[model samples]
Target: MEKDSGKHPLFFVTERLEFPPVEYTNEEGLLAVGGDLSPERLLLAYQSGIFPWFNEDSLILWWSPDPRMVLFPNKIKISKSMRKVLDSGQFRLTKNTRFDDVIDLCAQSPRKDQHGTWITQSMKKAYKRLHEIGMAKSYEVWEGSELVGGLYGIDLGHVFCGESMFSKVSNASKFAFIKLAQDLEKKNYKLIDCQVYTPHLESLGAEEMPRENFIKILNEKN
Candidate 1:
């Protein structure tokens, strides 16, 4: 994957846990910039397709952007008014119970033109230590005992890397992203990364692709 004389890679990773080969990223897909999100460097940065976006006043910024923005969990797109708001069950989905109140309300939601929050506070204690070693998760959309909507990510078995979402009312984050994409398409989960690009996740069906075919589906072993 050669090409790296333009200076970008910088993850000494406390003496190398390694991560500089997504074609040695640079033209804005950054690559590395001082790592330490340690859940073994965020599971070796999503097993090398890489992640960790910046902006709690910058500096810990690694990425692998290219065309990325995935979704594929059985092509998730249920529009007829979101299937009548999931058959009007009136929101009450939960997984991983509360995940520090759905990542403290997705680090205090609010990001149209963006101003702050890349879910910082050491990325919420390094994703609550990758949700206490299970590889990070959280999808709550309750409305009974309150907690409006939710989302959280990084589940890389077959990739579920979402990362952020919030909503206090109106459709409650699209019913917590359509019940986490129909429960990761009943566990077959080939993808969901949605790393960048938004028209609200391209109207629920996320698309984009090539970063060398998403690192060839992140070097599949699932």
Candidate 2:
């Protein structure tokens, strides 16, 4: 999840939809500011291993943090209990079936120690457009007919730049994630870009990778 704190200090902002090298980012990985979320810009950003993470109150903040968090698809860990959750078949998953509902639910899901969401209205529209164009994708989890949890992200073939996820019921989002990793593993994906660290993701085998290494992998995979 892109649940980042604070902002870059007085970096240059441009109305032009361009980003500098990830190496130019401040210590916090705030690259440049003030770019529109156009499809071309968004795709270029992901391809460069950068993503936007500002809220409505601030200008669009693109980030490419050092010690980036990532999950190799083959390394995803499923605890014994979670394995049972999957074995029980309590929930089902779908891909690109309910992108709109998945993103909207993720925006509404609450986070501890966080107020409001970073998934702004314009952000949603931009990503939705990407989805329409096959550059973005979503995975949905359902219990019976009710949608419970899911995630959405930019798909750059071998590298999936995960944006965010939400779970309404226990283990629902985990189900979605595990399913995604397994499916992607079968498809020969190199990694899932978790963006930053969180205990929740670490439990599922996400680890911090050097920024240069991450960018190198993106280049190699893309």
Candidate 3:
């Protein structure tokens, strides 16, 4: 990755696209921005530690920021309250079930201090396509046959790039996340690409590292 000083970033047309160096001024990681979110491009981006994150009206912005946030499957912290909730057995967890529903709920569920959502319709369509191709998966939490909480993400070789998650019932999403961590660990997955930082994720033992270090881990696993 080399710093690009050009006025506008280049657009990559091939499956394998190079990301501009993180040393550039933009913390946004605006590397080679505009491109269609074809399955090929999405797969290549994930494999190269790049991801698309932009609004509906914006161009397909690709990002590979300097400080990457990630979580190791085995390192997820289970709070005492969450453990009790899991033990209660009020909700059942299912894999690859109601993925579109999960993403929809994630987009609709309101955060405490936020309005609107980052998961636009176009993003939904792209990820749904990824799911159809088996590159993405969702975990659904069911309470007596009703979908209450769930999460979705892209699953590469040994990494799960989490997109978004939502919970209608208390601790439902957390329970699903814990199950995901356990399942991924059993399958020998190395890390979870969280994309950005949040206090909720930090409480679950996510940590931030330099982007170079994160890419090193990705390359090592590859």
Candidate with top lDDT is 2
- lDDT-better candidate, 2 vs 3: 2
Q: TM-scores for all candidates?
A: 0.35, 0.94, 0.89
Tens-place lDDT per residue, model 2, 51-135, is 9999989988889999899999999999999999999989988899999989999999999999999999999999999999999
lDDT, residue 151, model 3: 95
Could you tell me which 10 consecutive residues in candidate 2 have the lowest summed lDDT?
Answer: 1-10
Q: Write the per-residue lDDT of candidate 1 for residues 53-85, one digit (tens) a residue.
A: 878877787788898899887777888987898
Q: List CA RMSD, all candidates.
A: 14.2, 4.1, 2.8
Best-first order by lDDT: 2, 3, 1
Model 1: how far is 69 from its true place, Å?
A: 1.1
Best by TM-score: 2
Q: Over 4 Å off in model 2, which ranges?
A: 1-17
Candidate lDDT (C-alpha), each: 0.81, 0.90, 0.83
Q: Which residue pairs show backbone clashes in model 3? A: none
For candidate 2, give the lDDT.
Answer: 0.90
Give candidate 3's TM-score. 0.89
User: Taking the tens digit of each residue's C-alpha lDDT, what string does model 3 give over 104-192?
Assistant: 89999997777687788988999999999899999999898889999999998788999889998888898888999999999999899
